[model samples]
Target: MPDIVDDKSEQCIRFLLDCLDAHRKQHAGDDAPPPPFFLGLNGVQGSGKSTLVSLLKNKLESEPHNLSTAILSIDDFYLPHSAQQALAASHPQNPLVQHRGQPSTHDISLLKSTFNSLKTRHPVALPCYDKSAFAGQGDRTPETTWTRVNGPDQRSIDIIIFEGWCVGFRSLSAVQLESKWSAAVGANMKPAYAGRLGKLELESVTLVNEALRQYDEVTDMLDAFVLIDAEDTQYVYAWRLEQEAALRRERGSGMTDEQVVSFVNGYYPAYELYTEALRRGIFPGVEGRQLVFELGKDRRVKDVKKI
Candidate 1:
């Protein structure tokens, strides 16, 4: 968590602070403290989001800003090990539901309740998920170990940063789903763009799409959004490979290149299916609050668009 500000971090800080300024202006006359500004951040896996979050939080919590920021990851709201196993058991035939990477694997009720609690601006323990638990299958860390914030005695939270690979994903209608699926099926046959969506059954993808609808309950709460888009979604595989290679270098053991490919394959279908919808825009009728960073295969920003 070094307080380092690189070019990307500088751009993000500018966007986020502008958002904060707008939020404060909106509540200029209010007596009660403005509710914690909710910011939704979405990035493709292995896109350096975690590093960006750390840098952004540091900037907000120190020096001139001195804002109390609480970080929450959608990954922390994932189903516990037992629940995830049960999900896989129930949806034995649906490969998407058989793991924790897709929409249906999250604990939607818990997420909703957490958001509700944050809105109250009261003491709440942020949920934590241990991805290393149960030999990397993952589980929720115990409540006692979770971080507590916004208490009467503690610094009141001013901003809540909710980030995840699929934070602001919107659900699709049946027609849209079918159109995307059919197009992906055609694309999959060719070697030009190798993606995972066409390999999954339409019924399986539909189940995930329906589950995504539940996430809108949380998405609507976001006051602002940041989308870290990639020019090629397939770059995720190479990015993840580099991540695991670094992990193995430091930890002596980690997923191999083949396992990394398999793991990413599990989540690639959602990227293929929904990333376009996000690129088009997640917040319609509301402008100036959303920021999109289009990144090349090298993970450098190619363009910045404010929507």
Candidate 2:
């Protein structure tokens, strides 16, 4: 949340404001009631998704309008660490722990319910997930919980920004190269010293296919989709490392860099595959589709192409 104008986050905020302005103008003469705008912002880990949302909220709050806005992150829906630990124990040999950032780890029902309630202009309780503890903190809820203002003079919510690493990603079947089985075995074996483990591969592709269908439902509700295209997987990896380092320092865990890298590796394959699809134009969310910005390696606009 630094007030650095040069940062990509600042640019993202400006873009969102421009969109809101256009929306207001387009509906200026319409007698039809204006619907609440939902902006979906997606990016890879450490791609400034949360920072951009915070900046957008600040910008909106400063503007004089009855316009109420809320920012929701998919991270808030992460399964508690205890739930994750149970899964790991059940399938000790499986790489589900590494699947933390993947679609399989999110509670789709909770997300769908939250969105449904928000659309109705009702007060909705948003969950808060703790990153360090890998569980829900049960406090520190969203500042502007969705609520309908009373009276005919009440101003309606003009915008809602739903941002997350995989917000717009369509869940697909887990595609594991046969070559990766050996590597999976090696990684899963390390935890045997702590408890008995079972050898399980990635979740069946059918589950992934079903998850993608759920993602489709979420996207179908979006008014606009913004993708934060990372330069490459290497860039995302570096950003994640920096974040993890800061997190470990704050917790005083004294974890070595090697240990952190090893832990992060578990979630790397899924992220790499998903981002590769974006680069190759095969991403279901962006194949010849609209995008808010085409971000590049230098964190500058590489091109402003319409989706």
How high is each candidate's TM-score? 0.95, 0.69
Best by lDDT: 1
In the order shown, the candidates' Cα RMSDs to the true structure are: 2.1, 6.6
After superposition, the stretches of candidate 1 with alpha carbons farther than 4 Å from their true spots are 1-6
All models: lDDT? 0.88, 0.58
Model 1 TM: 0.95
> Per-residue lDDT for 141-223 in model 1, tens only?
99999988877889888889999999999998999999999998988888885888988889999999999999998999998
Model 2, position 8, has a per-residue lDDT of 55
lDDT of 2 at 186: 63
